[model samples]
Target: RQIRSRFIDEVDSGVVRTETGATITQKADRFSLDESSSPKKSTSATSIEYDWETPVSGKTYKSASGSTIEYDLQDGDDPFQVGVIVEHAKFGPGKIISRTGLGMDAKVVVFFKSRGQKKLMLKAAPLQVIG
Candidate 1:
């Protein structure tokens, strides 16, 4: 007998598709050492595979002043400027509430419309500034 399962693991802008398969084999009753014993127990083994991908984070947004700005977050750069408008693929639009630390250790707190507040790492978070 065989069993299979599949699922998607998502974190910020990154996504992983996981698939797993298991196979089980039972011994015939005649092969059992004791004729009166229950059917021989079987062990099942599972194999798993994953496919990962990351989508683009944010886009260039134009403000009311007609000025264009780039809002995407990049590694080794400070992306969180307090009070800036930013958008997250999963959390929608939000505003930067506060920020702490520097470089890869930097963290930003954002308040979203649908998801409320969230704290994210600057380098790993899938966030983009809108204004």
Candidate 2:
């Protein structure tokens, strides 16, 4: 969707062309929600902070954006612990719901946003730790 929005922006600015070399007419690219249009946005007076606890790994994570994600991935031996987000070529993106084993023999049960929960081998699973 983000790529599609950028393509529309390019098309609106007359930077995109069709296969037949046809160019679109340029016009205003301003949106009602853009910073140039709506300069002031409402916000809460009190800052609210939250935390998430992983069901499988029994770990709690804090995210400023309200999403539980860990960034210190360089210090961990087991990267597939609960609350870790991972991306797979086939499974897309998901959170690790459960995991077992160790090293190359490890397995994780990830709950993919689009594909739902799936168990995959840590090795040869086309997985990348992305939390």
The lDDT leader among the candidates is 2
> lDDT of all predictions, in order shown?
0.57, 0.58
Q: Who wins the TM-score comparison?
A: 2
| Local lDDT at 118 for model 2 | 93
Model 2 lDDT tens row, 1-131: 23335455454433443433333344466422223322232222354322212122433444333544333323355677889999987779999898886544578899998999899876546667898
Which whole-number lDDT from 0 to 100 does residue 55 have in model 2? Answer: 20
On the 0 to 100 scale, the lDDT of residue 20 in model 2 is 34
Please, what are the lDDT tens digits per residue for candidate 1 over residues 1-131?
43322211112111221122222222432211222322332222343332223323465655434546554656534446788899987799999999997544568999998999999876566677788
Cα displacement (angstroms), candidate 1, residue 72, comes to 12
TM-score of model 1 vs. true structure: 0.40
* Stretches of candidate 1 exceeding 4 Å from the true structure: 1-79
Mark the regions of model 2 whose C-alpha exceeds 4 Å error after superposition. Answer: 1-76
Each candidate: how many clashes? Answer: 0, 0
What's the true lDDT of residue 106 in model 1? 68
